[model samples]
Target: MRASRLRRAFAVAAAAGAMVFSVAGTSGSAASGMPAAPRLPGVQADTLAERYGANDDFIEKSERAARRMGDTARADHLAELAEPGRQFLSFDPRDDGLAVEVLGDLAHADRVAVVVPGSDTTIDTFDELGTRYAALAGGARAVHAEMRRLSPDTKVAVVAWLGYHAPRTLSRDVVTTARAQAGGAQLRVFVAQLKQANPAAPVTLICHSYGSAVCGSAVENPASTAAPLDNLAGIAVVGSPGMGLRSASDLAVRVPLWVGRGADDWIAGVPHASVSVPGATIGFGTDPLSREFGARTFDAGRGGHSDYFKPGGLALHNLALIGLGHGEAVSHD
Candidate 1:
């Protein structure tokens, strides 16, 4: 009886989300006429400089294409990305776009944090001032900066990874696991690449909101053809809906998992349950912050969903500690 009621509730929620948010339009501009980017470089510490140069060239070309297409906003944004000091491991200004930006010296860093953003994240909105997705880049910068402040002698790097077509928050897609599954696969591949580049560095996935679902999928489903991610130090999720699993033990990897939710986060209202339907799962199950999930919980203060990475915030400080493998120092809820 309980299971039946849960399924019915999921169906209603899914239908409501579709009716309210599924607009009859594409997510973003396709950037169809943009020039092709250079081939991504092989994952190697020695090729870091070469990869940055190639991505820089691609950014310049993309900037020109955006200008030609009369998209001043996009062109201006690309121009900033192409600046001399900025470094990007990868850039693709097509479709919703994908980019992996490094904030510190990745080649020399022994600890690395890969920041995965949630819904509504795209190239155009990467660092846009008013959007919630702005936290994607902002959070990465905050984590990087906080890590430096916490342990200046330690070598750490933060990578802002916008590598998937994130679903819109109001859309039906956000309620399903399809996007998360695909993103998880991509994340797995990217982590493999990261390991290949620097085998000694311990990588931690810092996921936010929907991105936590992606990380959950990534850790839950390892590629059959690829080796396991042995260098994964930990995973930290903030403002999450759910991780598509019943419990932390369900995770395929046995790494340390940590979760934090802001005191006033709207996500706390989301139903933490999943129900199987005809073609897909309707929700992500098991709230990471719940005692039943069996993951460490952290104090996120009184901010809302988008404030986890706010400078000097408790959440940001704990995130840095987790990413740096100093889990003992994170403040619990």
Candidate 2:
């Protein structure tokens, strides 16, 4: 059985390498043909209004640049982003773009949930209103809405964090930990900054699919300073492949970790094992929902991978409960 597993791992690795080579030859770099954006502000809650203005200016400038370059679709999208009442904590137009948007009153919230997305999530597809990828932003909004519905008196906020260059599903990078490692470093910094801005509010990380690997990496490798993530409430991963760890106990922190998966998620077929190559480790090991991994399981219902955040779904309801620090109320499998 061990030999068979190893052979399967190598076969997948070989296929991934071939795909990587083919894509490298045909596709341009992530940052290629992107318009330059303005500098972003430091993460400071007191200066959020000014920061929002700065990001709006950045979006407008990038919009003009895109327009000049004849990319009307991108320019139109930027125009929508620059519209009034949209609050972006950070915005970078270059390199597949990165945006961190708040869905509620962040300064006054008692609880904050950061929604980290999976693969194929980009600025262009961030909130494609009527599609599965809509969860990139729509999921955050749904969580915020559900939190309000569940506890009207509680102050809550949800952040749609598209702060990394997610790999395409078909790419070799999807099976490797390189992107997750880099993204995990960035997530740690961002969370630290967020804690500094709002020391009173507890933050929860809600990660999906490959985003689960990013969350796992972030938890596995914490900064070596005191209270690096002081007010982290909890972490929940849905539709995950694996968390790049042998067990939940391997996590660096002692916080509560939850895992859930829809019954029909295609990710179920992916190998939950890692193999070390020359310089990188391929695949995230240990299924999060497995007993050996030792994570609290939640009922994700019968939906597919993208339906986790569907309105009125069990997954979304449980996710909202978890994000609100109401783990006791979350339904178990």
Candidate 3:
């Protein structure tokens, strides 16, 4: 993503200055609770009130949600995730009583991939932008094909988790650890629902951009639950800011982890992994891409933040590997 785009992602109340980040540990005074969401797409007025009157209407049931997922036009979750004027954070809607689409036939399948997209991204972005303009997901799609291509025994269902409050543009806050902690509770709930829906399936979470932050916080218990973040064959984070924990080892789940950045990614240059909490601030001790993450590295070339998903990119190719339980790094270009 471009610096200008990054700035636009963040709806910061303060004017741009040198973004100050907290260097302290996760114990920092960051609000370890849920972050609030702004109104949905402030631009268009819902002059005609939504039909559902109950608050729970905003949240859909899992059974119906799964059907919605398979039908693209009925994609309420996507609209909620990218609707401007709403909070830019994305999480599993099933966790928040919101709607979510279920894909993949896990009963007979062997693998699954939950794709989490970053800022300025949408359902259209992956299918439209990445397919024609860039080579992202080229490899991701290959992995899907490879799953069926190489192993007919495995069935892969990839969910585009564009759910989280994105940077709106790119504010240090949007890229920090605070949001993770804030949204942790909801994330856990979402994962729980996903697992509940498909108990035996092995799940892999693929987080990109600020989506990584959601993963970081999800493991830490933003909602303060004893049910730890469990289940997972792997986690792949690309163009990430920082998991804020110093190491992926800190994550409650110990699945194989992978991290890589396009050398040209400006997000890697963002100064402090400063995450502001309610009273104080927190810092992700070290770079998440470090050995601490317990993940192998991939070469994204000069592709910036969003490049990993670009077609024919190694990052996208490797994502297929990770998603398919093939941890070995692969080349796309």
Candidate 4:
């Protein structure tokens, strides 16, 4: 009876999330001003300076476009994020959206952390001020600050990679990996570009919630990739439902896998299994923090779902340690 009730609750939540995704999806197409990226051969930017400059240029154009459309809120937000000292790896402002910001200098950094956010994240959400608790950009900034503080000597950079369409937390799409498949491909390309831009720097993927599914799918499928993933040092998943894989071995990445789950996170209740339906597969498989997943579990304290990157939280501390490549400093269960 208890298990049946849980399933019913998930079904309802999934339905709600699906409705939200539908609304967001309709608006998203008009918001991404640029066409889909072309199939380029080499680095997207010849140098870090060039990348930053190009992004700023794009932001300026986006700002003007936003004003023309009478979206002053978006214009103002872009203006703030496009300040002189800020560096963006990429920026596109159209309907719903994609923006990748570098929290620190990527060119000279010894280690870099790429943060992938989960459900209900959109460019509008990314631009919203004072919602750091719920925004990917704010979360990235906080994580970057913590990384700098914890590893003072290590020049670390954090990239807020809002590159994919995140599903709604209460929708049916949240239960499937279809969006994750597309997101994973995009992530793979971005990571490949990063590697080509800076071959020596160690890159770690810090995937949160549903973002872990993206990372998992990207690494699991090798034949679909244009470039091989040889630059990653580690992959850390926080507050995840699952990674669409049964075990760490299934991820097929030659790096350390770190998994963390906060005590107060409701995702712990998500069934750690998957089932195939007529059109698609529902549910991601094997919780990352579970022993059968073969991932190194860490102590993420008792914070809620979004608290992994919260300032001074144990999860943030551990994440910073991981971002800095100081695995020894991370606390284990």
The window of 10 residues in a row where model 1 has the poorest summed lDDT is 21-30
Give the alpha carbon lDDT tens digit for every residue of 50-109 in model 2: 778888888887878777777676778778788889888888877467899988888888
Candidate models: Cα lDDT each: 0.84, 0.82, 0.51, 0.80
List the candidates' TM-scores in order.
0.92, 0.90, 0.62, 0.88
Off by over 4 Å in 2: 1-36, 129-133, 221-227
- Clash total of candidate 4: 11
Candidate 1 Cα outliers beyond 4 Å, as residue runs: 1-30, 129-134, 221-223
lDDT of 1 by residue, 1-333 (tens): 534655665567667667765442233374887887788769788999899989989999899988988878778878877888778898888766888898888878989999999987877667763643345777788889999999999999899999888876656678789999899988888887888778899999999999999999889956578557888889999999898878899777789999999999999978777877789887798889989999989898899988888888899999999998999888987
Model 3 ranges off by over 4 Å? 1-13, 16-99, 121-152, 221-224, 275-285, 292-294, 329-333
Question: Which candidate, 3 or 4, would have the higher TM-score against the true structure?
Answer: 4
Each model's backbone clash number: 0, 0, 33, 11
Per-residue alpha-carbon lDDT of model 3 for 17-67, expressed as tens digits? 223222111111221221333233311113112211211233233224534
Candidates arranged by TM-score, highest first = 1, 2, 4, 3
- Please report the TM-score between candidate 3 and the true structure: 0.62
